[model samples]
Target: MPTTDNQGSFLNLISIRRNQVTAMDNDQELEDLELFQKNVADLFSGFLASAEEPSSAKSGVETIDSPVTARDNYIPPPPLLSISWFRNLLDAFLCCEAEFKAVLVSGRDPSQFTRPPLDRLIPDLLERSIKALDVCNAVTHGVELVRHWQKLAQIAVTALQQNPIGEGQVRRARKALTALLASTVFDVKENSNGNVHGKSAERSWSFGRRGGGGGATMNNKDPNGRNLSSFSWSVAKSWSSAKQIQAMSANLAAPRGGESTGLALPVYIISTILVFVMWALVAAIPCQERTGLATHLPLPKQLAWAQPLVSLQEKIGEEWKKKEKKGNAGLLEEVHRMEKLAQSLVEFADSFVFPMEEEKATAVAAQVKELAEICEKMEEGLGPLQQQVREVFHRIVRSRAEVLDVLDPVTKLPTPVPY
Candidate 1:
């Protein structure tokens, strides 16, 4: 009933409106993705800021006098790997991971993931996340190791806190400190030697039947003469943290060309974040065989988040190098403090006099107070941190499952069993 020209005109108008609507939707999606990326960057930026702040454990602050100007531009020294910092890191991951899952769900078309780039990218991200689960398990075990050290240190604390500070008390404290130091050194040596399930794992940093608590001299026995290694390892003995990290970071590079836009970009962003978080965890927390573990953060400078992440990675890397130089076990601030304070206490007890002098008694009390403070912090923080790690583990598993549910049937890719 209508002329061909009129029909064409009407269809053209409809097509134009449809295109306008599509353009608006695409723009909105892009904006949302960018905002997500910015939020993640901000979270890590906060972490970097906290890392640069002065440690709360310090008793006094030293100010520097500059003749040039009096602007008071003394920046704080970077903090060590702390429980609070690690918890915040985990919290950031959970938030970013949730937002990432939302982005994937927002795509509206399940078939989009089956398309080029995303089809490969999505599966790779999921697989990397699966590998992270084992690392989480290993980190949880590391937390247990720290807890064991805390308990042994507490024994020394209890003994040293005696009111009279007698010879007997000194002897008891020295014995506990000796055991504690030996266990920590043994753990580090084992990790360095790449022997994960050696006596270190068996005792979880406890003194074995050996009199001096030396790992080499100790038999296959716990301090309490029970098998504690059964409770030590959550992952397989052969699971090396460094190797697992390398596997996750393998082929992880910045998305380019067409892959740098739309969903693929966000996928790549999340992947980088995933690797960085796991790398940081491995660096800060003691895991099985973390020798030669390297940081794997590909800083794509074009993205707003990459700069801060790269900065944090470099700072962490520097800290790792410093720790390695000192033959330290991990970058955990409390652990470092504990090791120093415990060693000093052991030296003090070893050189103790029969009638403890007043100055010496005061020094011992101060060290005991500091040790107790660290113990208190560990008591409050480690349990929650271990629980948070478990939550992270379960979340990764759940996310991988959700993604596999969406992609497996459509892409016909092999579904990996949840780790």
Candidate 2:
């Protein structure tokens, strides 16, 4: 047998060899990890670049060499792919960060690694993710806003048709609708090969009917802890359906006289049914505080008729300034309220009837004179309020144009028509 000293030396040599092999294996893993980080970084960079670039669609049948710079020509970035990439990138970054921290805790010196610092990359990843989410949310909100406007337009058009408003009034309503549509931006759908095609008008009203309050549940989490893309997708589908409805309404509004009336009857019946359903649903659903910037700014109560209209005008102006600094953030709720009030006013006006007999006609004429005087008073009171509302809308359109500039610098945003 060997001496004690020799045996000790032999054991030392074996330990040294084992340590060398283990170090080599660790270095290989570190290299692989570095490569993964590089790849992820590249992907992230590409995604940001694409996000910043203006969206373009390949025209299938109509190819034009000259580029169009109008707002109508501008398309929103592809949300599905962008959102997927963001999720994957975020997950990968999180994993890498955790692994890196563990390695650091386990006495591995980061100075030995040639890769970028996890500390720097993680923060950058987080910042980008937040920005991406904001952009997505803003786009989603825009779609919803446009949808609300379309609904209002539909109601207005239907009301005008049913009442047989003068030709001038009909023309004005159509012009307004067209102007609103032209100013709005929408997403372009892509095919499997990533080419955009003209979207078909498929009746998707079922989405709205089926979308219970659950569809708006943003905090919904999956069993496996994965964030579902379904929430955003549902919103997108609803938006698409809204676009279809708007198109249908526009078509129905195109014809004049009995043709328009006939075309609109079915829609009116459907709308009336929907209104009942909506009322029921509204009653069933507990009222929640408005989301976004609107939560903080509440509309002032209407002033008493005894108060001067000037006081009301001042209050509205002040409130609008406070709420509209960052854009028409809370204006949509106000617009909705105004539209409802206008509709009610129209109904109230329609309630009055005059008789054909001489004595009755005289009495009715006096009542009509009184009614006109009251209307004039109401109009005077609302004139400043309406003017302020119009200003807020114009500001919103300008803000949207700025967002479009960031999204697509090449395309020019259309100017908002003065109300």
Candidate 3:
């Protein structure tokens, strides 16, 4: 019923209205994309700011200025916000992924969006998260740190599963986490093992040797029939005689131990004189230094009686050195074992691909959780061993101090007067 001109005008008006509707829709989509970007940026900024804050005692405690703590002595930071930042970050990532997919589905050119590219931005976020976690691990030595890292790693794994674009970053994070956990386990075991061995060595060193019998057991009486109480006196006499002999010989150019003393005293005469002088001195010295008359004997002959204590000290030193060597070798072995395990973990992570099947994903998750539990158990086991090591070390130090106190006066006894 309408005229030709009126129909044409109506079609033109409809076209304009349709164009307006399309423009409005495009504008709303742009605004939404912008809002999504701003939200992502704000969340990430907050997370980074929190992560960068210096970890001090104050972080775990409520500040005086906190409104919730105004009525209380002190309150700890809530577990949800303080410890669950990684989980929150992961949730943000998931949201970002969903928005990005929506943008793709809307037939809008992502390149036209005035924001950072998704490929670059997502990877950067993942990398920063991993670095933050690494800092957390380095600064803290608590099991809580391990647990938190594991949670972050699990989330990262999920992120990788959801979005393949950030796979490289996610893989790197997994490798780092695996390496950290492996090294921690290794260190705990190695330290515990070393401490155990050291404790055993300390016990043997302290209780096995007789205190003043020149390394003989208390059950074994001296073969020469000397009283135990007089052992220290005998040792002092021998040491003094040896020093005198050393001082006298300083001016002489004696042959080395295996070398012959050409045209010296006859062997039989030297031996007989040595035996006679030793008994005479022991009978007469009475823990006193021999003076003028005793200088008639040669320097080498005077040192004979001191040989037992010197030999005993040398044996003790050798035993200590052997124990040290054994401990070092054990530590090296443990380090190598850890290195191998870390390498295997890294390889596994590198080769990993997020399984498409639900069963496979669940299985992988289970395995990771189990590994974390094992590490936790190892840490717990090391606790008691570490304590034992500390106690043993203190005991050894105390016992040594006591022994030195007892021996100090005798060792510092005045040198015998030279003949």
Candidate 4:
């Protein structure tokens, strides 16, 4: 086509893309029509394809999205693949970004979405939002994701009269997911198997060394080869599944009569195999388990401080009512969720997986229950008239932090502080 015609066509395409983004604003429309996502892949593909098109002056074909311009081609972030059997979470990312974008287009700030969207997209949105936020959340300084989540929550509630994705649950989980994603570091290549116990790696000098470094051997004893537990073939295979695993070398392929084969014939051949196997397993255990705390544990430990928070919550509620007699509903609900989440934070910090665990878990669960209640209030309390309620929530969290010293993880006791 002519130069002017090419320019016009490109502008038309850009307009089409922008319109697609705009159309996605309504969650119901986006989900029902599947416009944004379907268009997203194609639009991005076109944008990438356009990069290959040379300048018209150089050849014949012209660009579409115009790679020469300083704009990203739009590769959506992939999801967390914390498993041996899974591939990239691009599916998860696409799903989540659509949800995030849908909420943002719906007019709420992306960070301020408080719940999953309605219009039958709640479950899918919740799953994607969690991971999509993880991309934004994968770093601490990036608080922008929080705004996105807050907006998501808002769109979800406004769009659905009755949502299958519980308003309170999504809010709490979103908050926790955001926190974990932001706080923890993500390691991509780490394995996900075995209990950790110190193990040594089998390295070699290979200077025509006395014994060859062993070849790759499967360690059934260790998922990560801690050798802390005995290896079973099924266990070893399961743990090392879908990963770049290590091998062990035991025997020498060299000539027994060779002059170079000097040194200690004093050792039993079988003993070397046993020694290498045991030690190798020990070295690999912890390394395999280090995908980061966020990957291993989802969100915060389910709240364990619910019961204690109930009475305390009532008191906080009364106190909030007294201090902030007037209100902004949205602010109030935000405050309430914050308070309960904060309480859950304390309880979760105190929890442990073993020994004296039941009590701590129970306490934490109670806190979660309170958090759930607060989430409900926050959802109901959203609007322009609940600002005071929000403040009350702040005060409650602050006061609770003071009342209960930080929970100690090891001892499972409240920290001793001057009270």
User: Which candidate wins on TM-score?
Assistant: 1
Show pairs that collide, candidate 1. none
> Model 3, 1-419: lDDT tens per residue?
56998999999999999999989976876566555546544644554444445454234555455576453654332121222332343344445444544443345433322122323322222222222222121112222223333344444444334433245754665666564554344322122211212111111111222345333112224578754211111111122222332343233332344322211111212222222222222211111122221323233433332233223223323432433222121111122233344444455566666443566456545544544444454344333422332232233233333323433434222322111
- Please give the lDDT score at residue 189 for candidate 2: 28
Candidate 3 or 1, higher TM-score: 1
Name the regions of candidate 1 deviating beyond 4 angstroms.
Answer: 1-3, 54-80, 187-237, 324-328, 413-419
- Better model by lDDT: candidate 1 vs candidate 4: 1
TM-score of each: 0.82, 0.26, 0.26, 0.17
* lDDT, candidate 2, 1-419, per-residue tens: 56998999999999999999889966865664455435434544444444444334422223365355544565443321222222333343334334433333235433322122323322222222222222222233333343344453544444444333444544454454443333322222211001113233322211121125421124346788885322232122223222322222222212235522221222222222222211211111111111121211111123121122223223333444454222222233323333343444344334434323566445434433443333343334323322332232233233323322332422222321111
Q: Select the stronger candidate by TM-score from 1 and 4.
A: 1
The best candidate by lDDT is: 1
Report lDDT (Cα) of residue 139, candidate 4.
Answer: 18
| TM-score of predicted structure 3 | 0.26
Query: Which candidate model has the greater lDDT, 3 or 4?
Result: 3
| CA-lDDT, candidates in order | 0.73, 0.32, 0.34, 0.28
Ranking by TM-score: 1, 3, 2, 4
Instruction: Give a tens-digit lDDT track for model 1, residues 237-319.
Output: 46577888898888687877866768887888888888888888888777767777885455676777887888888888887
Runs in model 2 lying further than 4 Å from the true structure: 21-25, 48-419
- Which window of 10 residues has the lowest lDDT sum in candidate 4? 79-88
